[model samples]
Target: MKFTSEEDTYSWAVEFGKSLQPGDKVAMFGNLGAGKTVISRGVCKGLGFEGSVCSPTYTILHEYPNNPPIFHFDLYRLEGGADLYEVGLDPDYLSQGISLIEWPERLEGNDPGLTHIIRIEILNETEREITLEKI
Candidate 1:
């Protein structure tokens, strides 16, 4: 998808969120300033989260108490998959809610049958190429 602006990116994510199901896991790939958090906030909005949706880089995870619930993870600080357990990101937690993981590469060997892989690339100063691959 070609997004000319941040709003476009967010709107696209909202539409993408409509297709999401409980226990669906999304692995997001993008460089810094690629609007990852913006799209994430949009997904949260689509999932009925009324509050702000910020990156959980420091906390590692953010859980929004919505009808279907949203689990946002930022693994930028982790060493590898072995640290996921320490953050309480076990099977139970992932299976019970919609998960969106940023920096998914940090998940060494963890692969819970990801439903989607979203990759955002900077096409220009004001345009972005967002690709969603369903698995």
Candidate 2:
């Protein structure tokens, strides 16, 4: 998908988010400032989260109390899945709700429940190439 602006990306993501359900997991892949959090916000909006959605970079995770709950994880500073444990993430919560993971490469463990993978490539200063695939 070619997104000429952030609104385009967020709009597309909102539609995608509406299709998610409990146990759904989405992994976001892109470089720094690639608008991962923007997509996340759109997803949360589509999921009926009325509050704000911000990046969990410093906090590592942000839990939104939606219908199925939203476990938003930013693993940019972490090394692997083991680090997730150290950060107080229960492996079981992943299956009970929706999950959005940034820097998913840090999660070395197998995530069979992951339902979607969103890869964004920067095409220029104002354009982005996004690929959304279902698992």
Candidate 3:
């Protein structure tokens, strides 16, 4: 869907968040300044999380405690697949909470099944086109 503003993007994320279940993995694909973090913040709001939500760029991952918890990961700086494994991001983490991964193209795996892939393309400074593909 094409979002003309950040509010529209957040609205789409809120709607998407309503359908998420524990253990759901959402892989977000986008370039810098693509508003991935904005969508994530909206998901946090939709999930009833009161804490601040920001991109896990330097930290790599940020875990938020909601009813089921949310695991937000930014693999943009990861060196390789080994880094992912070293961080204990195996299938086990997927069973504990919702996994939202940015820069998931660095992941070394197949479909991983039943995953939601969100592709965001920047249309302008404040506009974006988001495509949610279920796999």
Top TM-score hit: 1
Q: How much is the lDDT of residue 129 in candidate 1?
A: 96
Candidate 1 runs further than 4 Å off: none
Off by over 4 Å in 3: 110-114
Sequence-dependent TM-score of model 1: 0.93
- Model 1 clash pairs are none
Residue 21: error of model 3 in Å?
0.3
RMSD in Å for candidate 1, one decimal? 1.3
lDDT of 1 by residue, 1-135 (tens): 899999999998888887898989999999998988998999988887889899999999999998798999888888876456776668787888899989888888777568999999998878999999999
**Candidate 2 residues 11-119, lDDT tens each?**
9888988999988989999999898999999999989898999999999989999898999988898866645556545668677789998888887874535789999
Among all windows of 10 consecutive residues in model 3, the one with the lowest summed lDDT is 79-88
What are the per-model C-alpha RMSD values against the true structure? 1.3, 1.7, 1.7
- If both were scored by TM-score, which would come out higher, candidate 1 or candidate 3? 1
Worst 10 residues of 1 by lDDT: 80-89
Which stretches of candidate 2 lie above 4 Å from their native place? 80-84, 87-89, 109-112
What is the Å distance of residue 130 in model 1 from its true position? 0.8
